[model samples]
Structure formats: C-alpha cells, structure tokens
Target: MGKLLTLAKEIIFPSRTTCFICGREEIVGEDDLCDACRESIHLCICPPAPLPLDGVSAGLLYTKELHEPMHRFKYRDKVEYAAFFCQYMSIPQDWSIDILCPVPLYYLREMKRTYNQSELLARRISAIYQIPYCRDLLEKTRNTATQTRLNPAQRQRNVQNAFKAAPECKNLSVLLIDDVYTTGATLASCAKELKKQGASKVYALCACKTDN
Candidate 1:
C-alpha cells in the first residue's frame, strides 16, 4: 500500500502506467494491469460458506490484489482505498439484513490504530446497499495476538471469549464486518457472542479471504 505508492511516486513522469500489484510499467486501466497479469492474479469467487455459525456474506477472495489496499486502508489511513471493498464485492443473494456490524476489535488496538478496519468495510457495504450501520452492536472482550502467527487450533483457542454483543441489539440480524477471513475462528467467536446477545440472525461481510 503505502510502500507501493511511495515507490510508484519515485517513477512518475509525464505519462506513466504500472501494474497496481507488481508495478510493471504496463498497466492498462485505472490502477489496473494488463490482461495477462490481471487474469493471472486468480481473482477467485468462493461459494457462500454456510455461515459456519449463522448467515454470512463475503465478496472477494483475499488474494494478492486485496491484501495491499486493505493493508493501506487500515495502517496508512488511505480511506479512499475502501473503494476496493465494493469495487470487487459480489453481494450474496442469501444476505438480506437490517443492520451491519463490525467484528469488534479490542479497545487498545482500536485506540492505537484510531480506527477499526472492519468497521470501515462495514460502512462501505452499508452505503452501497442502503442498509443501516450498527457499528456498536459488538465489542471485543479480550485482546488476542495476531491470528496468522498461530496455528489453526491455537487460532480457535485465541479468539474464544474475545467478543461480546450489546444488550440493546435484539431481534436484529447482524451483518458482521472484517477486512479478511482465514480460519474463521475470529468470526465464529463473534457469532457466538451475537447469538448470546439475542440476535435473531447474524451475517458477515469481509473485503477478502483465502480458501473460500
């Protein structure tokens, strides 16, 4: 993200185009790449997983393209990068929800980052679908370590008891939001919390994910 753009800036001249991902000076479209490169990126479409806990929805596979913008959107505050969320989103036909929710982050991280990346994605979805945003319906109860650094079993255990839902949300279908999905343990924990809080239904949306 920032690193990509910073490098890109160094090469700027009168008229220059570069692949958004690899920066090959042969980009074809707006912040895009040539056909072979674009197709080679493996922009896969994942069949809707059965919510794993309840109703869920997601857009793109967290392949190479999605990783950078999502990273910049959070770490660099490039809010405009959020466009990539819906720029590639494929709304699930199964999803019909009243409100959108972000998988809550621990307060310390949110304060440190000054924004919740998941909530930012949620707002984009809400705006596009004309749905309501309920950003506060979920809360993080524990600050867990990065899920990727841990194995699958450890990831599951790490996210357990990490999330909770607000008491005010009842009879509501929650649409949980996050930047990416991997093992889904984090989402499962959040779903459990939403169920415990009396949410009639829970759905989720993320910018990208791998392995469907």
Candidate 2:
C-alpha cells in the first residue's frame, strides 16, 4: 500500500528526474544533467580575486543554454533547482570559511518572492559541506535597482551602501554565496560591509559566471 501511494504521488507530481538543462530523461546524473548537457556546461576558470575578496570561484560559465533555467530559478519560483545548482559548487581548500552568508535581497523583495534564491543556495551548500550558515550576518538595507541592465560602474554604484553586516561578523572568515557573479560589484560591496564590521577575510562562490 505504501509503495502504491508513493507511485501515485510520483505520477501526480513528477519528480525532477529529467535533465534540467536539456529536459532529457535518459540517465540524468546526480546534478540533474544528462551526459550530453553535462558535457556542454562550461566550468568557470576564474581569474584572481578582485579587491576585498580573498578568493572566488564559480561552478559554470553563464552560457545562453543556461540562461533560461537560471531565470526560472531566480524569478519563476523554481526553488527546487537550488539542489541541482549547489552540487557543482566546490569550496577551495585554502579558505578557512567560518560561515556561509548569502548575498541578501531587500526585505520587500524577499517578502514578495517568498524566498531569496541566494539563501536557498547557501543553505543547501552549508548542509552539503557541513559548514554553518548565518542569514542574520549580512542584510540588504536598500532596494537598489536590478543590476541586469546596468553597466559596470553603474552596477557598483547601485549596491553601494546597500548592505549592512552584524557586529558578530568580527574576526570571522565569511564565504558569500550568490546565484551569479557578473561584475563582482555586488559581492565586493557586501564584502566591504562585512570587513567594516570587522570580518577578517571574505570569499565568494557562485553558481555561474558570465563569460565576459
């Protein structure tokens, strides 16, 4: 009876067994990508960390193939997609991160969305890597314009003074988690606030990075 009930549930609301990238049902791996789509994913070979970030890494290069799914994950309530994305994020051996801090969304924005996508990624990463995560440590204080259409300098200005860090961040090494790394503007702004609150080091990890 239990098996029959479970099978009914599967039939009613299908599980995410299909490849997230190509929607292929054939032998999808644990990351939710079939062999062909998985091979097509371009891993990010990051350059040196920009100012204020001690280190940085990302899982995939943000290609056109990934854009649709990523948009859905962020804006279309595809929250379950966090599990598939976090599987590819790896923490570097050198950074002694004390806590995972998701780059925050403005309270109103989060309230409207019902969840912060970055926080979802951070929680999954913390569970997988056995590292603690603290959403209270950093906060978005301002509802800045979205960085999507902004140029590099404009992106920097948009997030300036947009975040505040808790005093508890003092002396701790923090790893900032976000869905994408584009201009490094948002992460750097968040890192600056953390440092001002006395954080010793800051690093960043993202699900994807634009190939620009």
Give each model a TM-score. 0.80, 0.89
Model 2 CA lDDT for position 91? 93
Q: For model 2, how does the per-residue alpha-carbon lDDT over 48-78 read when each residue is reduced to its tens digit?
A: 8778999889988999889989999999999
The collision pairs in model 2 are none
Once model 1 is optimally superposed onto the true structure by TM-score, how far is the C-alpha of residue 81 displaced, in angstroms? 1.4
- Candidate 2 matches the true fold with a TM-score of 0.89
lDDT for predicted candidate 2 compared with the true structure? 0.92
Instruction: Please report, in order, the local distance difference test score of every candidate based on alpha carbons.
Output: 0.72, 0.92
For candidate 1, what is the TM-score?
0.80
Off by over 4 Å in 1: 1-19, 23-37, 47-52
Local error of candidate 2 at residue 154 (angstroms): 0.7
